[model samples]
Target: MYSTHLSPMQTYLVSENLKKMVSEDWRREKLHSNIAYFKTKMKNANRTVMPSGSAIQPIWIGDEKVALSVSEQLKQKGIWLTAIRYPTVAKGAARLRLTLTTDHTHDDIDFLVKSLVECTYD
Candidate 1:
């Protein structure tokens, strides 16, 4: 997964817009809320760490619709999805490893996690 570190200036810009531009403020507020939601979900997801330096977010592929949809969406957004399959991952240990980046908004990550959960559960 990718690492995200917000620079002070960037944080200030967002905070300022939250106080200035109405549209930008709304977007920023939504993103912040979404990030909080996703972070909570991730903490509960019981992700696994593989020997290959990859992180496996506890996703059950027996239900593929949610995960697949999220993966496709991520690929479309230039976020690569590295799926661990049967041959590559041990039995009953498949998952989606998302590499996060600084370029990604918190909203992007939230949407992704939400999409995965929706697809897997539905």
Candidate 2:
């Protein structure tokens, strides 16, 4: 029912972008580049981002209270990082999810890293 009955507009959009979505050029240029950019920025900031080969990198906060507090702080700063908690992870293993995309520029990443550092230290 999902793929079998996409609306006409949905079909049009997907068909139009399908080639780019699966293209090697897109992956090598956009996806891989953004991932590298984000990881490098995080590492340079000395933030503990778990090694993830994809767009979503997890920064472990370990304590649920700290994770939730940081999540709120980032939210107030206009960044939306969800605090992952127990049941999703073992107790004492909370984290903040950092997602990067081709739409994000280096400046954006820099500001995010700065904000993160500030939020954690404040």
Candidate 3:
């Protein structure tokens, strides 16, 4: 038997409550803070963090081999990231793209940045 769910009115009320819990100001601040943290980490590692109007930022690694290896290494560390390679991008324009979301905490960003730095060096 299918479980009963909230009525339309109940659903609307729950949605409204969720909206009130997360304000636009709070979301914007969190996103900006996360991006700033990432930028600082990349800078300290002597890596370039590309600016984007979107939430995803690409850190150019240049070589496809390096990018792939780094992606795998980061995965082993439990930080999942994708290596943007040829066809999707020009040859020798490979990168590791990171997405910043309001749900991510400062510690989460730090771990990712540290893992990236360590993996690149490895």
Ten contiguous residues minimizing lDDT sum, candidate 3: 1-10
| TM-score (C-alpha) between model 3 and the true structure | 0.76
Q: Can you list the residue pairs that collide in candidate 3?
A: none
CA lDDT of every candidate = 0.53, 0.83, 0.82
Error of 2 at 29 (Å): 2.0
Give candidate 1's TM-score: 0.41
Alpha-carbon runs more than 4 Å astray in model 2: 1-20
Assess the local accuracy of residue 20 in candidate 2 as a C-alpha lDDT between 0 and 100: 74
Write model 1 residue lDDT over 9-102, tens digit each, in one string. Answer: 9999988965765555555565455544445666566432232322223344533444466566657756677555455556655566654433
Model 2 agreement with the true structure over 42-119: per-residue lDDT tens digits: 788888888798778899788999999999999999999999988778899989988787788888888888888888
TM-scores for all candidates: the values are: 0.41, 0.78, 0.76
- Tell me which of candidates 1 and 3 scores higher on TM-score: 3
Of the two candidates 1 and 2, the one with more favorable lDDT, higher being better, is 2
- RMSD versus native structure for model 3: 8.0
What is the full ranking by TM-score, best candidate first? 2, 3, 1
Leading candidate by TM-score: 2
